[model samples]
Target: MRRREGGARTGRGVGVLRVVVVGLMVTLVGRLWFLQVVSGDRYVRAAAGVSVRTVALAPLRGQILDAAGRPLVANRTVPVVSVDGVALAHQADGGRAVLGRLAAALRQPYGRLAGKIRMCGPGVARPCWPGSPYEPIPVADAVPVQVALQITERQADFPGVTTELRPIRVYPYGRAAGHTLGYLQAGVGRDGLEAVYDRDLAGRPGRRVVAVDNAGNVTRVVGQDPATAGNSLVTSLDARIQVIAERALATALARTGGTSGAAVVLESATGRVAALAGYPGYDPSVWTGGVTAGQYAGLQLLSRAVQGQWAPGSTWKVASVAAAANAGYRLDARYGCPSGYTVGDRLFRNFGSADLGTMTMRGALVKSCDTVFYRIADELWRRGSDVPRRTATGFGFGARTGIDLPGEAVGAVPAASARPGDAANFAIGQGGVLVTPLQLARAYAALANGGTLYAPRVGERVVRPDGTTVRSIVPPVTGRLPASAATLAFIRGALSDVPRSGTASAAFKGFPFGRIAVAGKTGTAESAGHRDTSWFASFAPDPAYTVVVVLSEGGRGAQGAAPAARQIWEGIDGLRETR
Candidate 1:
């Protein structure tokens, strides 16, 4: 009986064990079905998240070339050191140890390197990496080959460090056309043509969908879109002429003890600027890494010939002469050439207060008689006529010349309610009548081009990477001068006499007038508590180029600005001979 009872208990225990084992198998099958049918896609995406990365490929920036196709602004490739922010973040101590090791290898300050890699917050100093945390941030540019090799060879020391070749903007000419060509900051245009045509110059950036492994290494490129290089800008600037203008302006500034100076050379017929140069220019390469406070402060002294405004001084007499002619004041009419003209309590005088007794209107202009213009301004003011204002505005004064540059100053003109004193001042290009070197050049160009006022153009054409012409810039005529042919001719002939026997005669005494009929005017504007501003505006008929030079705090037009203009004209003549 005991044996039979034991056998029954054993059978029961076996049956319970079988039931438990079967239930466990059923549960496993249900979980497998749910995972395979309902959650498979989610798991697959999660797996891909660990291996896929998006890489941005920067496109090559187009070359900024001169009229002769010489590069003023360009690009070059150099090895750069980058850090993977995401991978670095995941490292111990937020990748500080690795960055510290990298700092030693790169010979860079660890604090600065760490600051650049770290995400910036409020109050963080600049030079901070501005890219996304997931993307690789370039820490060192133009890294030495040996340093890059050292970092690459010791990957264990820098888990997230990478060395690769990248394109960087270069200014081969250094400070030659720095203002006009503009400078780049972190692959962005800041000013000049670069800022004005940024969209066209900065081409589309390409992207690549890459597959990276758990070790943060690229396994394969799943998809790629090639970057398109920016279109090349063909400027109207003549590199040779630019050098000549800058040199002349610098020499004149030093000789005259002037603080600053600006010079502009334009194609008289088309109003296309050949060269725009200013003193105290800055090097564009200083912006490669980014400009510092000191560097930027130093650049504040830079002046743009097309943008900055100053009292045009006697160079303004061209407009005054045209205005008088338009108002039926005979060009040949004789007036008393006095040493000084009194208006209200102020006494305005010509250079040296030398009285030439009596002289015609043409003679008055040749000698830059301030009293003659003062009398003309008095008559116009008495008549309550806008002829003077109209004439000045007609010459594109007190307004933007529509130049192909940014931040151009639209100079101020006397208001309608201007008094006789203001009129007198305006007549001589004073009393809030300001003009840019480019504007003065444009006005002189209009006189040279038979009364057509052209909107100044700098871009000659746009071309593709293969040298195919994308589009050519057509010179646009802004307006026509109101002066008659006789008046224009009279003004032209009088201006021609200027370099012969007028204010600029001394400067152009030995110039070859037979080969080239050069016409010009000289101006000196008084500045209270400072040296007078000197000006010289001239044009050569042979090559049809208008050159305007202005020296701030320079003594006299003939002594300071005229000599500089002479140098430029001679340089232009020499250039023609060589070519």
Candidate 2:
């Protein structure tokens, strides 16, 4: 009986021991579940707080080329110095002394570095800087490779400072055709063709998921996303021809005491814009790579020709003549500009303030008599605005040119408000109207090409990186001038007589360029402060080319703009003969 009692007590003690062991295992599993599943996101946050680091990869920018495949805007390998703003914050123990050390290493002004670092403040716990932790601070751009190498060698002391290979836009031709090529900023297109073709020019950016250690240091590259470089584009501008136009315009502007100037050369048959130049033209390289504050201020002051709308002066006469011819108006009809004619309530005065007795249509044009055009404008107004408006549209007036560039404007012509003064002013290229130098160039091309108004094309082609021809720009015939053969002949004869007998006669009297018959007209438009928009548009040798030059504030078309046109003709003829 005693042995049975002992056995029962032993079994109960063993059962208690088994239950305690099971309880211990259950407690351990519950604690593990609480620590892992309940707080998984929190642990991830802790890991990121200690070990995530980011890096940036840049893409290549496209090349801008001119006609004949010469590079106008190109990309060159350049060394740029930058710093991971976030990395510097904690690595340099709040980055206070890191700024001074970085200044010494970069050999830059200590104060400038300090100023930037302080502005960044402290990027700990959360960022105190303007951008995210991955954002880089541009310490300096386009540093010399050797200088960058030296800085990199001592990067241990500089902490987060880095040197990378960057592509920099280079303009080998200076400000040759700045108004057309435009500029780039922050790997993005800012103005002109650069802005218009930003997507094509700025290639795709690459990225990588880098592995970082507990100290927020990049331990490995991990994986990479490769980047592709931008393609190359060819424009219609010829650097050599552009140089000629710029030199001529500058000399003319200086001689005329003009505030601004512009010029363009177009192919008569194809309507290709050979060269388009503007003065007081800003250097394209300055705006693209980087510009000083003072240079930027100066650019702001002279940003006119690209955006300025001005009275086209005598250049508008081309559109008027086209309109007149299109309307089948008598070209040889005699008209009188006796002192001045009355239009509406305004008494319009002749340019010379002298009476031009009854003269034929040809005589009216050669003499540039305000009275002749006045009567013509009145006739058009009487014929209804349709004839004139249609004529202007045919000539590409008041229409924005679809050039492969940004920030272009189509100047205005009078709407059918039917004001009498506008009619008279219309005859004189005044009232609510304006035209760009480019428009005059293209219209003159039509006159040279027997009245086939072709669209103005600027780019030649864009070659992809894979060696495929991506695009080739071709100009299209937009409109035609419907006129009698007799009227056309009469108008052509008068235009030829311009250099032969009119105001431009004195300027081109010598005919130094030889038997290349050139027909042109000169204009002087009135502006504020006695400033004038002087103009000269012409076509030479019929089958060859047409050149148009318009100057603003450039004294007189007779003494100012005309002489420049002559020089341009001389240069063009000389170059052609030599070639």
Candidate 3:
């Protein structure tokens, strides 16, 4: 009986054990099923996140070429040394030994190199890295081939250090047209053509899918999309002409003791800028790797060609001449060449207060007789004629030239409610009248091209890397001047005599007028507290090109600016030796 009772208790214990084991097995199987079917993709993605990384591949920037296909701003490949921040941080001594080794190989100070690798943040000064801490930091640019080879050859000593061939901007002309060509700061456009055409110049960036281990070491390149280089920019700037203009401007600035100046050469027919030069220039190469704020502020970064606004002076007389003709003043009519003209209790004196005998309207222009223009302006104001303002606007003043470059200044013009004195000043390009060198150039270009005013363009076309044309850039004709063919021809004939027997005659005393007939005007404007602003606006009468020069604090148009214009014309006509 006892044995039977013991056997029954053992059977019950075994049965209860079996039931508990079976329930445990069922829970384990259900959990495994849920994990495999419901959450499998989530875990897989998490796994991928740990091992895969995507890196951006920067595309090569395009080249800037001249009209003759010569490189103005170009690129060259150089070895750049870089250090991976994450890998360096994982070092036993926190990258000190590795950086020291790298510094020795690079012949750079260890402290300077370390400062460059440090991620920029609060309390950190620059030369500090401004990019992501996970990526490699470029510590050295344009490193020597030998130094780059040494570091790469000994990877164990310089862990995480790498040498890569990267393209950097090289100015073949060296500061020639620096302001117009613009520059790149840390691979981003800052001004001029670089900023305006940044999108087209900067092609699409590619991607690289890389695999890394737990220690963030790149194991393999999973996939890559090759970067597409930017399209090349073809500009209308003639390098030879640009050099000539620049040299001529420098000579003028030095000879006249002027502080600043600008010169523009434009193709009258197409309105293409051949040469645009500004004095007190700087080297664009200073912005290769990067530029400091202090360094940038100290540099003469302003492009006086498009950004400078000055009194048009007597160069404004041509527009006035057109206005007078439109107001029923006959071109052949005689106007007095008095010493001064009185208006509203104030006497507007001619330049040097000279009194000459009466002459025809054409002869007054030839002598640049200020009293004559002042009288005409007063008469127009008395009649309440809008011809002055209309002619000024039609000639492309008081508005931007719509150039492709950035930071263009829209000059000022007198309002409709101007007084007699104001009208006189406007006629002489003073008081409230202002015009940019570019605006004045465009105005003269319109006069040269027979009434068609263009918006002017520097870039001629965009081309692909394979030399295929992308698109031609043709600037539209903004408006038409109100001057008729007969009026234009008459004015042209008067201007033709300016360099030969007028105010600019002395400057062109020995110039070859027969070879290159230059039609122009000379102006010496008064400044309240500064020396007179000198101006000379001229164009070849055959209507091929127009050249304009202006000098601040320069004594007179004939003495300061006209000589430079002569030099440029000589160079343009390939008669530099003759002059």
Candidate 4:
């Protein structure tokens, strides 16, 4: 009976084991059906997500053209060599052997190439590619076509190396207008018009969704969007005038032994900057690949035209004379022309300490008599009015001229609490007064244009790729001079006399004034360690151009800065005759 009972239990156990085994098979079949039919598309999509990649296509940077539609800043296509970090990672020993072969072919250091391929790994120094690990890193740019061909033909050796045509920024004029047009680095603008209008110059970048393998190799292009080219920037710069200005400035600096200088020419009526030149100019192309520490350091001493500020010297006398006239000091009224004037404990002397007896205000301006202007400033200071400061501000001094280029400086003017000594100094454009070449140019332009002070402009217009005007830059009037027609006329006549028979007479001794009708002011400001800062602010009536020049540590305005201005005028004359 015990044996029979045991047999029944064993049979029941066998039956239960068979049922459990069958249930397991059925469950496996159900899961297989659900995976293969119900969720197959979802799994496939997940797999694709692991392989697909989106790449940002860089747009073609716009061309910066002069007013004549000639390109100052343009683009060139060059061959670029890139490395796939993902593919390199998949190799045995993390692509060390492959990278070694590449370094040998390219003649680059193995460690540098490795560091560029790695994505900020521990113990790796910078200049590492600041990009995704799955993306191809640019190892070399602007490489020779032969070098690119070598890598392209030897795919097996260079597993994931890519050769592509990349756009590089080019400056046709080179260092001619370097400071005005500025430079770019890694497809971004640095300074000048480049930085100010970067949004308009740098177009919208495109995108591409591509199917890539685990090795980061593009299997196929799934989707793409074409990049739009940037709009061409039409600048107010006249390339020919710019070249002439640069050559003239360079020649003057060489002749005077001056360390630095600046020259600017503006359209008197429109306030359009025709030529802006800075001494010790740099090549914008140097910023293309990358600038070295030494190369960048050299550029610091340059770019002084719109950026450098100094006392306007006698050039500020133009503003002072106008202020005096507006404040009811008669243009024809006579004042004593002494060699020096005493204000408190200080005695301010003229350029050569010459006394010309008593003379009218116009005579004072022509001779640039410091003592005559000192009396007017003293009278105004005693009355305690802001006419001097107001007059200077109205003519665009003591503030930025709102030029299109970057790094402009707003010159300083004395406050209402200024003392008689300060006022006397300010009258001669000395004391705490400061002015940039650009600011002085604008002020002189306002006088030339009959009281309209237009904010200076560099960019003229923007053009689309299809040759349509995006927008035009109309020269906006910032402020109008408070001086009336008679006051402006009197000042204009006095300025005309300056180049003809006044302080700047020696510089313009042989200049043909019949056709041009040149008018100007010469200034010499005292410096602590150097000789003086020379200045020349001039304008023409016929063709209507305002030119301002400054020489740091230069001896005399008539000798140093005036000659440069004369050369520029000669260039303008040549341009006109040719036209």
Candidate 5:
């Protein structure tokens, strides 16, 4: 009976083992069927999605044209050599062998070619690419057509290399209007007009759908969305005038041995900038490919016309006269014009210390009598009036002119004070009073245009690729002069006589007043340790053009800055004659 029971237990155990094995076999078959039939399409779609990529093709940058439709900053097409980083990765030797072959063909070093395609990360330096690893990296831009064709035709020898047409900035006038025209770096504007209107100049980028293999190598282009070109910017700049202004500035620097300077030509009535020039100018093209921080800093790319802050010297007399007149001082009444005027412990002497006795405010302006204006400032200070500061602010001084450019300097104006020499210095545009060349031009423009102060306009309009108008740029009216029409008229008459018989007369000795009657002021402000700052601010009453020239560390406004203005005025006269 015991033997029979043991045999039954063994049989039962064997049966249970067989049942468990069958159950596992059924479960495996079910899982296999589910994978093959239920979710097969989903997995396949995911795998295909992993192999596709969409590339962004940058649009053709718009042209920056002058008022007469001449291009100051335009684009030129050139062949660009690029490498597919992903395809290079799939190469048998990790793209090294491919890059070596490419470097040999392109006349570049193997290391440089390899560096151009390397993904940028911590510890990686440029020449390294900056975007996604899948994007084609530009190895060389502006390559010759023959070299580009050689690489493209010999695809088997140089795998993953490509030649494409790319648009780049070209300055037709060279460095003529460098400051105003600005420049682009890697499709982004750096300063001036370029920075202000970058969005309008850089149009929408297009999409390019491409396919890649499992190894992340691009196989073929599938589809593309055509790019839309940017709208062209039309500026008020006259190309010829811009060239003339730059040439005149160069002449001034050479003649006066000035370290640096700025020049501006503005439409007095409309507030349109005709020509804006700056010294220590550079070719905008240098920023095309790339520039290191050291290289850029060494360029000294500041725009003195809009960014320079310097004392107006006697040029501040215009504002001072207005300030005094508006503060109830008589424009027709006579004031003392001594060789020097004392305030507290300081004595402010006239230029060359020559006194012309006593004269009206108008005569003081023509003579640029510092003592008379100093008295006006002293009186205003004694009365506790803010007329000087208010007049300066009203005339667009001690502040930005709100010109449509980046990096404009908001010049400083000291608060109202009775600190002895402070009022006298402030009245003569000395002490802490400061103004930019552009600001001075705008102020003179307002004086010439019946006291309508406008925010200087450089960009005139924006036009689409199809020649439709995007919008017209209208310079906003910033403010009106604080003085009355009679006070302004008297000031205008005095300024009109300045170039004819006053302080600037020597500089305008032979200037053709018959063709265009010119009016302006001459200023030579002391610049601390450096030489005096030379300034000449003038305008044509009839045609209404305001021209201002300033020379840093250049002595005598009548000697340095006025001559530059005269040269520019001569050129302008010629322009007017031709018209």
Candidate 6:
């Protein structure tokens, strides 16, 4: 009985001990649950602050092409050497040394790279900035394939350096199509067609937030979407003709000693701008280098050829003829050229200050008779401003041509003037008259296309990647000629005679455009300081192509501008002969 009692006591003691241990374990488990589940976010953020890193993925840029599907602008992928400031923050000594070496290789100040490193930190979600990866911090953009290969070969040496492909704009034609095609910088469009179509020309930038390891090495990518590139823009410019016009126009500018010059060649039937050139052109590729404030200032300072305007000289006479012809005035209407004509208070003299006697309406254009045109202007405006204004409107003059370009200004051909003297100027395209090279082209297109003023097109078409048409331009008829068809032909015939005997005789040199019945008109206007602005508006085969040349701050229209017109006409003739 004594042994049985002792064994029972020992069993009770052992049971109590087991209960105590179980209770202790329950308390420890509850504390652990509270720390892990309830306070998880705080601890996780703390851990991520040191370990997580992110990188950016830039989208591929769109392509730019000429009318013939030729690549006027191309893309290149360059390797960029970038440093993660957050990655480099923990490794300042090593980063500083690496940056110094990179700066030396790129011949830049080390502080530039250092400043870039400071912008990126462990706090940043993504450390890859698109520009300079090292200082301003740059890795390289659209890196050369050889450099990419070199990076691949020496991948071990470049720890934080990343080599990626990004699209950059390259002008294959050099400065040939500079003003028309414009350029892309960091895939952003600037000026001309590029600026006009920026939304379609530039793609969206993408982002990827990569989760890095404890060592600042990217472990896995997370919570990021790939970037999409911008769509391409195709221009209406013909590459071959663009080159020809640029070369010829540049040569003309050099020879003329004029302030500056511009040319516009259009398909008369379709109103397609074949070539638009502004001389002393700036390279569109220079934009890719990022236009320096100095360069931008230089471009801004350039104030001739394009935005500059002068008297259209005698070219105003064509508007006079078109006005009279369209107004049911006879082409054979008789007018006598005197020593000079007195209108308002000023006396208008012939070009050489000499007088030609009696001239028929067509004969007036042949001799560019000032008195005859002055008399006609008196007749048109003498009754009222309606005749001159109506005639100018029909030819699409004194207005913006509504071209698909930026910075176009509507020239001044005021319907109502401050004085009657302004009326005299209106008849001659003088006082308060302003028009652009683009405007002149559109007006000439009207003459070429039987008075149909189609909307001018530069961006011919935009075709989407999915084989859908993004946008398409259509033809438009602004207004009809004021004259009957016969009258229009009569005016056209007078214009035709211009190349043979009038102010434009020097333009064709010896070209046989007469066989095709090319019609044209020449204009010369002089301002207060004896400044000259010369013009030639020509169209061949009725509705084919039309070209307009305007030279500002030059000599007489027939003497200075006519030679350049001849060269262009000769080019057309050569092309036509071969065809």
Each candidate's clash count: 0, 0, 0, 0, 0, 28
* lDDT value, candidate 4, whole model: 0.85
Clashing pairs in 4: none
Best by lDDT: 3
Stretches of candidate 5 above 4 Å error? Answer: 1-42, 45-50, 92-115, 121-127, 153-157, 186-189
Residue-by-residue lDDT tens digits, candidate 3, 43-149? 77567754778887879988999999999989999998999988999999999999998988888778888877888779876667777555678887789899999
Candidates' RMSD to native:
7.7, 6.2, 5.8, 6.3, 5.7, 7.7
lDDT of 6 by residue, 314-402 (tens): 66666777777656677776778787888778887766777777878888877777777777676666676477677777677766567
Alpha carbon deviation, residue 245, candidate 6 (Å): 0.8
**Between 1 and 5, whose lDDT is larger?**
5
TM-score of 6: 0.81
lDDT of 2 at 317: 73
Name the weakest run of 10 consecutive residues (lDDT summed) in model 1.
292-301
TM-scores of the models, in the order given: 0.89, 0.83, 0.88, 0.88, 0.89, 0.81
lDDT of 2 by residue, 103-152 (tens): 77667766555444333334521112233345466666678777888878
Candidate of highest TM-score: 5
User: Which runs of model 4 end up more than 4 angstroms from their true locations?
Assistant: 1-42, 45-49, 91-128, 131-135, 186-189, 213-218, 292-294, 417-420
Per-residue lDDT over 1-579 for candidate 5, one digit per residue giving the tens place of the 0 to 100 score: 999999999999999999999989999988988887897865775777546788887799899999999999999988988888887777888878778877887787687677667787798876566776667787877888888999989899888888998887888999877888776564233787888899999999998887766767667888999999999999999999998999988898888889999999999999999999999999887776566545676885789999989998998888888888878888889899999988777888877898889898889989888889877787778778888898888888878888998899999889876577798899988999889999999988888889999999899999998889999999999899888899888988999888899888988998899888998899999988999999999998766799999999878888889989999999988988899
The C-alpha stretches of model 2 lying farther than 4 A from their native spots are 1-56, 91-93, 101-137, 187-189, 213-216, 288-295, 300-306, 326-328, 344-346, 379-386, 482-489, 512-515
CA lDDT, every prediction?
Answer: 0.84, 0.73, 0.87, 0.85, 0.86, 0.67
State residue 529's C-alpha deviation in candidate 4, in Å. Answer: 1.8
How far is 454's C-alpha from truth in model 1 (Å)? 1.5
Q: Cα RMSD (Å) between model 1 and the true structure? A: 7.7
Report model 2's TM-score to 2 decimal places. 0.83
CA lDDT, candidate 6, residue 428: 68
Assess the local accuracy of residue 184 in candidate 3 as a C-alpha lDDT between 0 and 100: 56
In model 3, residue pairs whose N, Cα or C atoms come closer than 3 Å (at least 3 residues apart or on different chains), thus clashing, are none
Error of 3 at 371 (Å): 0.4
